[model samples]
Target: MSKIVIGKYEGTIYPEKGGYTGALALGFGPDGKRRRLKRKGRTRSQVLDRLKAAVVDLETGVKSPANYNVGEAVEDWLAKGLRGLDDDTVVNYRSLAGKHVIPLIGKVRLKDLRADDVGEWLDGLAGSLSSRSLRLVHAILKRAIRQAQARDMVIRNVAELVKTPKGTAGRPSRALTLDQARAVLEAAQSSRLHAYVVVSLLTGIRTEEARAMQWDHVVAQADGEAGWRPVTADGFEHEKFAIYVWRSVRAHGDTKTEKSRRTLELPGQAAEALRRHHARQAAQRLRAGEEWRDHGLVFCSTTGRPLDAANVRRAFRLITRKAGIGESWSPRELRHSFVSIMSDSGVPIEAIADLCGHSSPAVTGEVYRHQLRPVITRGAEVADAVFGPGKSA
Candidate 1:
């Protein structure tokens, strides 16, 4: 059952919800029949407010065509291709549309949306987001407009013609020095979870990739001539000991990149740590008996599902704190530390990039350049040796 009411200042052509829980629709048309606005409100007050606002805009001749409304356009665009995107990507797009774009410029006509309006929106978004995220937002809007053009709603996408605003510098990353890394590992000695920190710092694998590692990816021992080798194509041979990167878990997507699909030589310490980890994991599996899921992930929950990224981060914080380091550090910093330490050892940039799964040396250079400043200083020391120490010409 529902109640119907006409507003004092504006006439309503549709019924309002009677219950206090759900929303009601207050729609109007010139012919007095429902106009099919296709809009619903979350509350009676919201519906009334929508009606009042629409009336005011119409009276002032400021209302755009029903098809031109930005909110409606976003809804239409979403219906077209939302299924193709990942769950997390779709969630973020919906959030941006609802919280930022819709609240700010939803009333603007799709055809009327100018570069200035988009620019103003982006300007407002500055300082609140990272440069990377702002770029994503710009990309989302541009795609939305392209979707609109495909439907023949707008002649051109103003978002395409507009420049995206620059975003603020995100928090700077600080990698742990060798001493600090040792301290963290020492503190992690009591934790079964130390295996996570060990692999991250030692291998420089991305968090997601590390989360996806399995026991099958590693080869501990091999007989004469048939040295330890990773499983490749359902066959095992004495391949190089470093060729064990082939057997990653079957996640939804491919490995980060073709380049990321690489095998790296683990340090002796890392190899020993992984051996101990495997032993411990086997014991736990034996204890669990039939209760274990046996997903075979090197790092996983007791039930064998992927470990929650948030839980890993929280555990990392605890490990860092016990190591007498500040908790402000992030798990990604461990990867940075790996790159920094290797670069300091005069490892070639390409080699470091390959080990870290970077797409290219350029990508690694951009992110870890500050970490490699010592490399330049070392180069200077080399130059000083060649040129002879500190003497004015």
Candidate 2:
């Protein structure tokens, strides 16, 4: 309950109390509703200044009585300010608060929270988490504190005064050699999933994009020279068989990027693999009958449901182990191999960039340079010719 006190002037005022921080919730005139006057400044004098301002405002009929907490401020911010953010981003923020921020300083009075408190919290965070994670924690807290200030709850946002730790970068990626890639494909040949592997390597599409492919996007109509059609007589295109990449499946949602949504011409080997896999999947669908989902996905489980990416990874690991290929690799490695092999084969970087749907050759080079280094070295042979016979430059 708010305590009512007559203003130094003529008006009666009710000032609410007991917030996350020190506050002065000033009420209004006799007939008018209450007005909240909180101190957002960190210093006592600052809080008093805010309180005095609220008192004057109440005397002048300016604002309403308001007193809120850190928790309340967070809820309001999430509801009103975070509406445009995606579900995953919201979930992540909530998780960060629950796991790290709230437990430490949630009980502190919004107005009473000090820079020292925020700094201590960050110091503790540094001991257990990566610099990046700590920075995230700081960012979340800073936003929450700023919101509290805007709401007139806190005297100051301590998070603003604290410094965030620097973040760490991960090691560079390692790509597979030509022999290793061939070995992986050969090992994958006997599996029902062989076509998927071939397409991933040949097309350089991400796993999610590859998995999301539908039967509608595979064009088989040779307009004349060398282009695939939107659809074929057998239901999809490609001489080897039907294939498509119309939609991607994600655990939380869909494809990671809008640009990843694309269609491409399937190579003969990949098309054949798809033909065989499609046949096998069709038989399974026939057996399942009413139990099948019929998602129309080109790559799916026996009942037409999308395969889990995690399950795909595990199976891929098994295939590599069986192939006697020891170096660590993931499905993405094949995408790198595609770029590498294309570059080595003398395909213009621009053309390869288009084939891989890369935004620019620079990005393609940056990502696959580990694999494309050999091409760069071989191109140096031109320098050898210019400099005279057999001179290593």
Maximum-lDDT candidate = 1
lDDT of 2 by residue, 1-393 (tens): 233233542222233343223344444758798755445444444555566666654555433234445555566666676665654467677887778887776766555567888888888877677787788778887887677566555566777888986545534455556666667777887875687887787677777677777766665755343555444244434343324444555543455555544556565666666667767887998899999998767778778887766567777777788778763567766777777766665666766666666677787777776666333322212212322233221
TM of each candidate vs. truth: 0.66, 0.62
TM-score, candidate 1, is: 0.66
**Candidate number achieving the greatest TM-score relative to the actual structure:** 1
Off by over 4 Å in 2: 1-164, 189-193, 222-227, 230-263, 287-291, 301-303, 306-308, 324-328, 374-393
Off by over 4 Å in 1: 1-99, 106-112, 227-243, 246-252, 279-294, 358-363, 373-393
Clashes of each: 0, 19
CA lDDT of each candidate? 0.67, 0.63
Model 1 is weakest, by summed lDDT over 10 consecutive residues, at: 378-387
